[model samples]
Target: MLIPKLLWPLLEYEISTSSVESIEAIINTFTRKWLGFPPCQRDVAMYCRKAKLRLPLISIVEEYKCRKARLMTMLEDSDETAVRLFQSHLTINRKWKVCKAVEQEKKALK
Candidate 1:
């Protein structure tokens, strides 16, 4: 969880901008602050995968989900807090991918 002292203002901004992009920018900053120091590329991938899951309305949820699933499978040892936070922050209900009816129909045909 983000510390309240550091998070309240960001939340306030979220309330004002009313844009997922604004919230994502805040999250990217947070991710960089938390995970961008002296870690392996795999670590960055893990964090990014988890972030994509927790973040609402990511345009590429399917991709992130695949990556996260693979990472989760590879990790017998995992951080519970990170997983919980990812699960808790899931914003899927508030967002959806827009698809043309034709596109959806094509997928169904496949």
Candidate 2:
């Protein structure tokens, strides 16, 4: 999940100058050396699967905006400390959601 996000830009930038064979060679070499296995079609499939697992960044940002708006509405009628605690909880829950998404992506790759 995380590796694809970082590597995608580099891959896109390289694709223009590299032949498909050379690109596969590069990926195969890396996987053989780092992962201790020769690259297979399954590795490519896994990348595709992981890519599909991503939520659109705009959607995530919009969700946070909505949550903040809701929090602000609640704050207007609620205790400051209580609202702060709820906000903190919401943030933690968001983090957990991200972790779960990544975990699911990993599972899909398998």
List lDDT for all candidates, in order. 0.40, 0.42
TM-score of 2: 0.22
Model 1 error, position 91 (Å): 18
Q: Model 2, stretches more than 4 Å misplaced?
A: 1-58, 79-110
Model 1 RMSD to the real structure? 14.4
Q: Residue by residue across 1-110, what tens digits does model 2's lDDT show?
A: 54345344533232222243354556456654675544454444323435755322222233333444454446545767766455333333422343344446558989
Task: Highest lDDT: give the candidate number.
Answer: 2
Model 1 stretches with alpha carbons more than 4 Å out = 1-18, 38-97, 101-109
* lDDT tens digits, residue span 66-88, model 1: 33334333332456656644432
Q: Which residue pairs collide in model 2, if any? A: none
